[model samples]
Target: MIKNVIVGIDPGTTTAIAILDIEGKLLYLHSKRDWKREEIIKAILSFGRPIIIATDVNPPPKSVEKLASSFGCKIFYPEISFSVLEKQELVKAFVYKAKNEHEIDALAACVKAWKRYRSFFTRVSYLLSKKDASELFEEVIKKLLKEGKENVESIVEKMTRKREEPEERVEKPKEKGEKVLEEKEKKLEQAKKELEILTRVLSKRKAELLTYKRIKLSLEELEKCRKELEELKRANNILKRFERIRMKKFEPLVELESINSLELEKLDKLLGLENRVVYCNSLSNANVLNNFGIRALVTECEEEINVANLEFPVIKIEKEFIQDVDGVKCVKEDKLESLLAEVRKSGLIKWLENYRKRKENY
Candidate 1:
């Protein structure tokens, strides 16, 4: 007999009382400091039957319309405005994900101050229907400005009789004296081609005024050497901050002296060493301390590890001697000594135990 439809709320001092169920999910979200009128009529008499009470807290106070007319339910006011402040910020971000995110930011500032007090009758019925549609659009713009001033005075009296019939025609002074001597020889060949284009534009305006005075004296000597190199870089950054505050007040008296010995002469130069190896192999158990310090010895095979005398090679292994070597994947010597003690605790057995202690000290 599933019949429980409750949407009862009286949340004002800035709105909130949500109850929605007929599949509109949010079955209960109450606020106005958690209901009061007998816990909102015992949550609408425990939703046993009569429901539906959506009240964006409007003029609903004659004791909440006598408790929604003694609970027979049905009370829906819902017209808060400013688009209910984006539905009270999506109902205070989903009731601040179920409760107090600072009381859903103080119930979204009391539902934006109860939708600005129910937008004063929606702003006085939108300013009395915009003053009755602006006096019916100013009486249709004064009857289209009195029919555009009687069609602009009847097209200005028919363009004043075609301008007095082209000033009554006068002509023959002996055929205008040979058409005024061929229009004065065509105005003397257009004044001799405008005086040869004004003497080639005054010699290109005196060569662009001497290249605009040499680019305005090279932009005022590059703005006075950029203000004397910004005052010598602000006095060399205040003398490099007073020489870094006198080298931080004499850095512990120059790190307490002690520096005059000089004898560094071991120059068998491996020029800036980086994993170097050199071994012109006179194979005396060619270990080179099993691979970490040989820097040169190539009699040949060079291919550019900087050519001349190469010899790095020392990663040899060959011992736990079981030879089922054909693509060997055999394991058991107690799982190869627990996988070589987890590959010698992961430093890959320090270059195979320094190449088996340089082949057991040769």
Candidate 2:
């Protein structure tokens, strides 16, 4: 028997189809370009009998309406057209089954229809189980969709009574015929019991299938969270390394591009040259250093600057005494103090004698 199904269609140049059984389980998804009406009908019939035809839009396309008419199935469309984002979300869990946007939209429409009637289907299952007519699940569901709920209760009552009714007994003169009739009734009751058992088994399998789909979706989400956690761990490691570097003591040093009067004047105004160690490439402005309450000078001079009896020390540039911490150039305080001690040991630094000698030569 062809199982009852819901058929969702995307009717366009490239037509797409999605089929779901009455229990909302996915059955088939396909798309074909420029498919004729006859071919579409054939493809749908191959899967199962469609009890309802669904579309994503409120005012469904004429092609979809025609297909529903041809199949004599009920047409289902939402009150408001489903947006792209809504369609995407509806089918996100089953996205892997859809090969294209058309298939996704079709699946979304079918899923929406299933959700609308899912509660009603559950109630039908309950009522049928109460009446011991579980074997009438498919037939009753088909009628419930094609007909109405009120009619379904009466239909179920009639079907159950017909199955339970006993056959007529023959008179005692026809003993052989009576035996044959009794045997036939026994076999019929046994078949009904077997059919009910099969129906229950089918329902259980459908429930298991739904559980598997949910678990698959949960695993996908877990994978995404795992990747995000790894990224956060890597970022934290980098921050920790930077934190360690920041914990070290680093002395701030002001670097001058040139020793010209104007540049030094601007630097002194901006950063206050007082008690500030100034570094420069040349010592041409060494004579002006004492005007500011400068601590010392670090220069790349080949010869020492002989500022006439200047109290401030002049240290030559040493790569070992400099360190760059996070893009800011700084001097090593311990190394600078050791270099200053070595300079002071020479005794007054011979400042005046050297200045006078260099002046006379110039």
Candidate 3:
């Protein structure tokens, strides 16, 4: 008699299969790379006839549906796809450890299907126990599950009654030929059991080897990432050091309340402003500024300063350009250089005009 079993399949580049007995006990679990449909069917048949086929995804895969059709079994799938966490939780209680994700997924799918019909299994078991016909359990369940239309009590009653019936036959003396055939059958059964044990051992070793290869690859990838992170951190540190050096190049501006004869004279005496950049409100004594050897003048003057005659540039600037650092007003060296470039361009034009005029006069 063919035993009824539930089969779970995870199909992909790596296909996995898990089998559970009618009692929800795990009978077999295995996975292979690029397993063909025919190979899978052959492997599943080695366990028993499948009563149900299951998967871990919703909108069941066509491959799984086809497998179920091949077995003439019912298909079971979750309404939503099972998460990684859920799959892990489902398999945690089992003593068997799944070597890879595919195996775990197949096992989880089988467990889910068993849980779904667990109540019906319990009811059938209860009915059989009351009838005192535990031997008919597998036969009755196979009928109820496969047909799904049969009354459970009726099946139990019919099976029990059949078991009670006895058949009468004429007895003949046992022949030596019959004894030899019976011995061969027993030997064949023992050989089949031994082959199954060896296959399980071989599959376990293959799983271990596959797992080791994957772990090695993962370690290599982690090392590569660590090196990249270190390089990034080193680059970031170099940038921070370069920024500190660049900040040192900026000089604090000597603030002037206003730019006039008195202020220019006072600053010249106080700081010796030969090449100092000064900030002020307005330019009053442009002539005096040219004499002091002031490098450039920054101001918030709305009206333009006539710097055509004076050698130094009188640059108009908004308040945003000035940055206060450590209680001192300073401008970034790059920002100051850009402002100076604009001033110099105008100054150069004015100088070129005057030089041409002097040459013409000569």
Candidate 4:
């Protein structure tokens, strides 16, 4: 049923269908006012099977999509919507006469698709018989659609080599030749069955091997992430010990900030921080550290802030207060990114689980 024909459809209140050969010859053309989609599909199939379904509109109407999908043909439309003048100009060379606007539009689409793939069409039609050319054209189109694309000439060349293989020549008496032909035919049928079985087996094994490779990669990533989780758990335990020590140390009440009102001589006893100064970029950073049970000499206040529902001890210091401490250095910028990354790996785990299911099904 494969044929190198282009089918153009002008779908609306009236549906028009046109079929043209690879050489731009019009084989069939018709438009019906009340025809349903099924009737239109049948008329196109009656002429010859089509390789391309053409439409004058970009993002073709649903009627056109149904026809193209039913016929298993690639849909073609101009990148930009074609103007009436452009459609008329394109159709003029293809057909000598047209009864209606639908006919003109359908023929215009057919001509455009024919011209687009004309170079490859000429080579295929010239080198092979019509039947053989039809088969090769169908295969090449399938491959082009499936694999993004392969060069048309390269596909034709490979097919040519396959068809031109040498065949053995034999001579015998007429009666003996008939008997030998029958025996050879029986052997060929048996060989065909064996080839089919082996091909199925090979295809199945290839799929299994691909699944195995994907599963192996997923397992490795999962193990690495598990080890990282184990390390984070150990780090969390260390932070808990810091909290325990802070609870046991010093007075019941401590001066919250290093304000100017506080005396410099009594600063060590007034401030809880033992010669340490910690800076807070915003209120969020304090919330993150406190959630993990870690405490530091914060240089920001917790008063009147509602960022975290569970509040903790946060103190704000004046800009000049840090000058009282010596050898102060800022923390590295990447520490926050590293901490957030460890806490937000649920998405990664979900993705790996999905990948594993897809590979297993394949």
**Lowest lDDT block of 10, candidate 2:** 237-246
lDDT of 2 by residue, 1-362 (tens): 66778999998999999999878889899998998999999988998888789999979999999899898877899999999999988898789999998999899999998888878777777888998888777677767667766666677787678868996875575888888889999999999999999999999999999999899899999989897677667545544543454467545556777667786775565456788777777676577777887888876667766655575878776676677776555666777777777767554455566778899999
lDDT of 3 by residue, 1-362 (tens): 66678899999999999999868888898999999999999999998888789999998999999999887778999999999999988888663668789999999999999988887777887888998987676677667767784477788888888888896564455666687789999999999999999999999999999999999899999999998677667645544543454578765566777667776665565456788777777577666777878787777778776766777777777889877765456677888888889878867887899999999999
TM-score for each candidate, following the candidate numbering? 0.19, 0.42, 0.40, 0.41
What C-alpha RMSD separates each model from the true structure? Answer: 40.4, 34.7, 35.4, 34.2
TM-score of 1: 0.19
Whole-model Cα lDDT per candidate?
0.42, 0.79, 0.81, 0.64
Q: Is candidate 2 or candidate 3 better by lDDT?
A: 3
Instruction: For residues 43-124, write the lDDT of model 1, one tens digit per residue.
Output: 6456433334444445554654566567655454545522445545646545654454333432343344334323432333
Runs with alpha carbons beyond 4 Å of true place in candidate 3: 126-139, 146-151, 158-362
List candidate 2 segments past 4 Å from native: 129-135, 150-155, 162-362
Q: What order do candidates take by TM-score, descending?
A: 2, 4, 3, 1
Query: Please, what are the lDDT tens digits per residue for candidate 4 over residues 70-140?
Result: 87878888998789899888888755767799988988888888888788567655554543554566666
Question: Highest lDDT: which candidate?
Answer: 3
